[model samples]
Target chain A: MSPSIMTKGAIDCDIHPSVPNIEALLPYFNDHWRDTISQRGVHDLQTIAYPKNAPLTARPDWRPKLGMPAADANTISTQALDTFQTSIAICNCLYGVQLLMSEDLAAAFASAVNDWMIAELLNKDPRLRASIVIPTQNSEMAVAEIERVASDPRFVSILMLVMDEKPLGRRSYWPIYAAAQRHNMPICVHAGSAYKHPVTSVGWPSYYAEDYASQAPAFHNMVSSFICEGVFSEYPDLKVVLAESGFSWLPAHLWRLTKFWRGLRAEIPWVDRTPTEIARDHIRLTLQPVDAPPTSEQLERLMDHMGSDEMIIFSTDYPHWQFDGVDVIPDGISKELATKIMVENPKNTYPRLQ
Target chain B: MNIQLMDRVATDQKIKLAIADCDIHPAPKSVPVEIYPYLSKRWQDYMETYGIIYRQGFPTGPAFPKGQPNAARRDAYPPGGGKPGSDLDFMRSQHLDANNVQLGILNPLSCGQGVQNQDFSAVYCNAVNHWQIAEWTSKESRLKASLMVPYEDPSASVKEIDLWGGDSNFAQILLLSRTAEPLGQRKYWPIFEAACRANLPVAVHAFGYGGAPVTGGGWPSFYIEEMVGHAENTQSLLTSMVFEGVFERFPTLKLILVEAGFAWLPALSWRLDKLWNRMRAEIPHVTRPPSELIRQHVWLTTQPMEEPEPREHLLDTIEWIGWEKLLFATDYPHWDFDEPSRALPIRVGKEQKEAFFLKNALELYNLN
Candidate 1:
């Protein structure tokens, strides 16, 4: 996987530009929040979603000696942009704002993360775009934040974690969805947790490996929720991007959902088309951390099972190690499929990316 | 059990293997009465007065009610008007004899797994254990029982396994895939320990009403979400067991996933191995790679099979998962039943087909 087959102008759908520390976000915070955070003597709110030194958290060679990896726009340009020759990269700053218990604090921290993303990363590079990190604790606040920052063309999507306080498709969150659709932004459910609930329904898993492995299934349930909750019917044009969610489990998942929908469509009559059709039209997934079979033939067949090349967009999940070397694209994907994934699908997914 | 009642004939492929259906549900005609003959009088009276509560909301029904009545194929209901799988004669005609099933393992989903009353749960499980033999397995030679135990109470679970574990008629120890905690936790190990002593494999069927939300985030809207959630729940448990060293602790124990889809097997194995390779110190008990552990220990039944648009893609996954690890299952009488003859890929060679249809179940259950 170390060799470069990647062509230029590929749009990396998900890349995390880590906030260096608590100090970096302090200026973006309001006078009340800035002094309140300092008065309380708080430290970096970075959740253990990614351990600082874990190999999965950061590729060893990409790690800086001084601070958090990919904390700066310069490192991202050289390490991700120049290497993959990507024209545009979306900075989904996964700092721990959503981890706050108090809705006010969550809103404050989320606002700070968004502002910092604009000032520190998105503005610094013409190639960098970002998702507006919303305070998911309260829908009104989340929507307010969306309205505030969404006007900036640099922000392409609304960022929410996959594992959150409630299923993201519930009625309570409709306001946020309404705001996102009104602004022509997709809801990007990135792979992270709010820590409010166990990563698994059974309870918290013992190892990070178990937590990480649980993400694909989490995506399965999330997609089902969105489709069955009539999120698509309510807002027909809205698209949801499952960032850092693996792809292999999808064909079977869609099959299962659509199969049941045939017998059980009456339960949710709004789902007029097959669930697979709904997903293909509205949902998209990132390419890196590919949880594919060992052979290229198998990978190709698996992608074929996706029923459309348009559902997957190009992503390196940069600075974090998904695969070693430049062989970012899985070996067996056909040149035509690769071109569709790299250029066309992404530009179509994010209107701003075009 | 009458041979003359058999409606359908076996295909040559089925006849050669003497195919086994790994998942067969055996419910009671009436909840307490059918089981009453087996239970002690005190528990019977207790059931009559209070009844069982699953502890999740809605005492009368499942948390997420099924779209179909009894969650069964409409054709599965008996002509005499009882729940599906309740009458042996109807089952023999419709499923067993019709499919030419050489051996069928009864899953009996209503076997007191999610019962709130632990004391009553223990006794109810014990009663169902006897009732299965009396009602179906004892009468039907082609059928076997999945020994029911109160998994919520492992000590009691061990007691149930102690009584029926050695019986060949009872093929495997039944535990739901969704438990109160991850199935791999040490609290549940004693059940596995008892299972090993009896030389019975633990089959984690895809049903558990352990009062937990079906999904990690929160409750989902529809039954469709719950239906797709089986794979997710099972995959999490598989990861939990591997990382928590359930396999290493009980090296000989085997696991079977019933009604849980197996398409994600190859990817999960790879992901688990990749993650565990870098984080071995956290769980030193798992000496081998997670994928290797999965290969040695885990097996899945092909039912509600992954029907990708181009069907051979299913075969491509099975090729990676290895044909030997799969056991053919119909999830008999369920609405989502898979007909064995049509379910498997046509491209698979005869030898691999034999392994999937018959050999895997035989070797896993140690039945002839």
Candidate 2:
């Protein structure tokens, strides 16, 4: 499998491949399940192909515009390897494990999507690397899927959406992180459609703008829960990347959490290192929504705080609205930071790419 | 002015010497109805529909209608909203003589942006609140203020309120309007509890927009749409307090509503009286008509006054809502700020005017 023309010079950190057609993927899901993929119009690939010229299918009166167009496997791989000039492409999602394991049958969907994704994407191209999706809805299945895919050279990391129902740092999720640690795979937590539960314990919000802004607090809680839960302390080798999430809120979040930890340090005594130390040692963040785009002042501030370029990773979140581009990166940041985010940091995190 | 001291003594029997000006505002630069000539055009038709006829420099007649040029910026405060009588500097210029006003409450026009933008729209809100507090409130002790919390999320609102509620200059927890359910609704309880714990008074100031409409009508495209939500928010807030049992639960809690004219109290009590007799089974938890609880726990500011009715009706409106619960404010810089010296008399006699102007406000704000 040769590197395609799209992988011309740099590595592509974020790419999406549509899972086998939505209908075809349905039978592979477990029984006692509802078929929401088709009902939700998740497989409108043709309309996505030529968005500006495409005719509007869903009535404006019935629904708000479904945000971003879905991308198929071929479209994803070609863009990453050829158009982006990447030596390696990290395919973050085909079908997340939570969706495929619709009912009580988690093991079946976990194994099925794993096999289907590899055959359709990985086996076809060596330049492409994928995250092994584990069935987060079912614990045993989640561990089993990671173990089965652990030995695959084409697999790079373990992927899951940030869920509010259980903090990723809880004992319930330690096994998944432990498995990633054993396999030398980093953990990638990406943003998803709103959670099945209210994103907060509170009731629903009144508008879409409310929904987007709420993501920051939930993200803060999940990270703190991870820290206080001792997920980082227990698995020192595990590297965590908050994927496709904006990074601007980082300064305030770190400040608040660190400030609170001062008075409440007794409860989480196992966390011997300071929160900032833990963040620098085991965590990396991908810049999207370009929360704090690089400018002379912003770059200076971020560099001063995070201390190294390795803490930042460049991600386009391609096929998603609000994608950050190379041009948006501020000119004042040293080329060294750009090289690390654009090339070195990603390569080092997922050794399969290296 | 002498009656103000007598009534303050009558309400609580506690006597104190400190003088507090409960409502004082450093108004912003006015949007010259001429500079953005379009504002006058857009707002004019709505003004006329409400029967507002204009004086050359000011909107002279009617409670809500009519156009008027607000006073030019006097020597002290800068050219902004508010007529000469209502400007902050005007109050300061007379501060030594007017009840020796020791502290003035500072409320800014820009603080209304959250309600104007759908509350939790962006990080811009956090930045906006930060700038307002850091820049404006730093120098003035007279400006004991309230921090505006974006109401989109109860958690963010709680977080911010708890974070800044401790600032010495911040006096109250400001929310755009009351929640949809009564105050006891658990969803809103977090904000109440946070405010209670901080010992900060929770205030609901009516804004010109953003609420479920009173009638089945969608939001009107014209600015006239504002009139719809003003009273609607007041009624929702009153229902939340009484039926939601907020007063019963947090007896020590203080809630104030500003810019919501106080004239509606008597009529609302009558309506509540009819509803409680007819609908007790529907809201049995409310041991009394909603008005009984409102008069005990709620306070409203007086601005946008109606013409002089009989002294008895004026006394009836205040007595029905509890005279101790009325606060006087010159809604400085808003389109409707009435001069304290003028708006005060048209509604009540000299003695009652003194109570509304200084005594009630001082007690409500906990200023001696």
Candidate 3:
């Protein structure tokens, strides 16, 4: 079911652009990457290589026809605004763009992508906002790209694929954070469609579903790394949004991480506040692909640990298989709290919205 | 034959239908003042130890929310709640009546604490086992017991098993799921071998009786989160037993996994078979499919069967895992214990219902 039309603006923090065809947009990217895509070796992107301005096909799913003739500003605007009724859509580059470029070339490709998204997609619809993609594999280039796009109001935050090279807290990536802080934008860390990292200490996960179930462990490590390395301390005003990550795992991670911190405070004396305290202040988490959606009782128990509603921000990793629909938000939570998750908390983080 | 006489006489074929709970815990009435009663006099004199005690009913530590002395600690400590740390009257009143089962096995919470104390594990385990026999197990006809042992010290563990074996009421040797080493290793053979000779089955229960660090981290504040992933520990336990040739060496030995729900068995079975075939060269002794050995010797309980998928699906899972291998359990008084009648709903058709609820447990636990 569709959400009720909001009397006030309803900001959508996440929206995935479905790419069912990609043959058209290949050449729109710079010609310097002729050998790069071939060397990267992701066959799926290569097989459906679309040429620039070729006639777009309406794939059965409403994914973008990348190599086909572009839908002009008006057609794209109507679908993103009138059809979806989203006041602001946080758009990003094509998910597979990085796979085609080396770490250095990826930064160039990222700048090219931001240029395309800002000029074509964001410029078309007043409601659409963009998250500037960075070449996460190379921090220096990523910082440069962030600074270049920092002045653009259409660009809201730095979009990070969770499995990107180096977690958010690594010293090499500090410059990228400095760039985001300089521009007053948050970093939006979203899950990627990769599971090559060791999800848990136990062993490699046995099934595809188990791998999906392990997003918490990944998010937990990122949160721990951020807190332990004093990332939040360094960037007191900068916010971090764990997008497309589930909410239930947050309370457990906060409790355990903070409790361990109490026993071993010497390990990280710089982290003055408890992990939860740091999280409530500088961090926000979204709730799509909620691994263990609680019953009313479970929700109350979880809220007890979370202590405040502001800790979570609402998101639907849209058009992906595990998206949350309108009715799934239970009436058990107070309307004010629900509104905070759905709108207010996100506004606090992504301030460039209409 | 009278019930007591028939209990002794009934063979595997008869299946005279006694519902036996393979796992149940009886917490200590009080942590004993004297930890090392049997230590050499010289050693005892040298060691006047600081053992944890139950002030109200929970273990006393330095303090609570603050590092308050005992006076302030009393205020913060949870009111000596349900069953007073495995009080028998509480177990019988809350569990026995609710489950309507014939027998309840008493596992000890402090047994793990004793095991962790290293030097004190042996004497402490002996004292707790004797206390269970005299106070809890002997008091009720329907109440049986499992002997806890000093798991780190294998010979001491075996001795504890032998001490309890003479008593028919002691049905199983209780092992904690979290141990220093895998049970299948050669180091644990003394304990398993002793269990075989004593004619007592081995039951491994989860270690989270009171703040035993769970697998991945420190203790979970909520019990539900700690309990959900318990089956993985049990799977580890079963793999250790099967591949270690515990079952192959002692053909009649039975291994029971307590409190870990039976739902994981089907998926685990498939995965084990895959691993056993792939790593067959490493474990030269385990020639057969791991599933076959598991079916032959291992059994599991269904306690706190949280939110079962449709009854048909529940039965479908059982069918896939061989229904006869499961035993009904009510992990009663521990906050989230399932009511047997409520948990084992009569939704499944009559034939499979009796097997899961009563018959299979009786056959496996030798409580005919």
lDDT tens digits by residue: candidate 2, B129-191: 454454345644465676666655567778877777667767777765533333345567777
Specify the highest-TM-score model's number.
Answer: 1
Q: What is the TM-score of chain B alone in each candidate?
A: 0.94, 0.68, 0.78
Native contacts present in candidate 3, fraction: 0.00
lDDT of each: 0.84, 0.54, 0.59
User: Where does candidate 2 stray beyond 4 Å?
Assistant: A1-8, A26-70, A94-103, A293-296, A323-330, B1-368
Query: To one decimal, what is the Cα RMSD in angstroms of model 2 from the true structure?
Result: 23.8
Ordered from best to worst lDDT, the candidate numbers read: 1, 3, 2
Residue A93 displacement in candidate 3 (angstroms): 4.3
Q: In candidate 3, what are the lDDT values of residues A219-262, reduced to their tens digit?
A: 65567667776888888888988886666556545544564465
> What ranking of all candidate models by DockQ puts the best one first?
1, 3, 2
Q: What is the C-alpha RMSD of each candidate to the true structure, in Å?
A: 3.9, 23.8, 14.3
lDDT of 2 by residue, A271-319 (tens): 7866666777777777544544223564355455454567777665555
User: What TM-score against the true fold does each predicted structure earn?
Assistant: 0.94, 0.48, 0.50
Runs of candidate 3 with Cα error greater than 4 angstroms are: A1-7, A19-22, A35-84, A97-101, A193-196, A291-294, A297-301, A323-325, B1-368
lDDT of 3 by residue, B1-368 (tens): 01111122223234333355555656554443323343445434534454433221344432122212221112222244423334566566555754566877777764533334555667666767777777776788888777878777888887778777767878788877656555666777888789888877888786533222333222222222233435544555565666666778778788888876675565455445644554455566776877888888888777645232123334445665677888777654353455454554434544566787778866766778
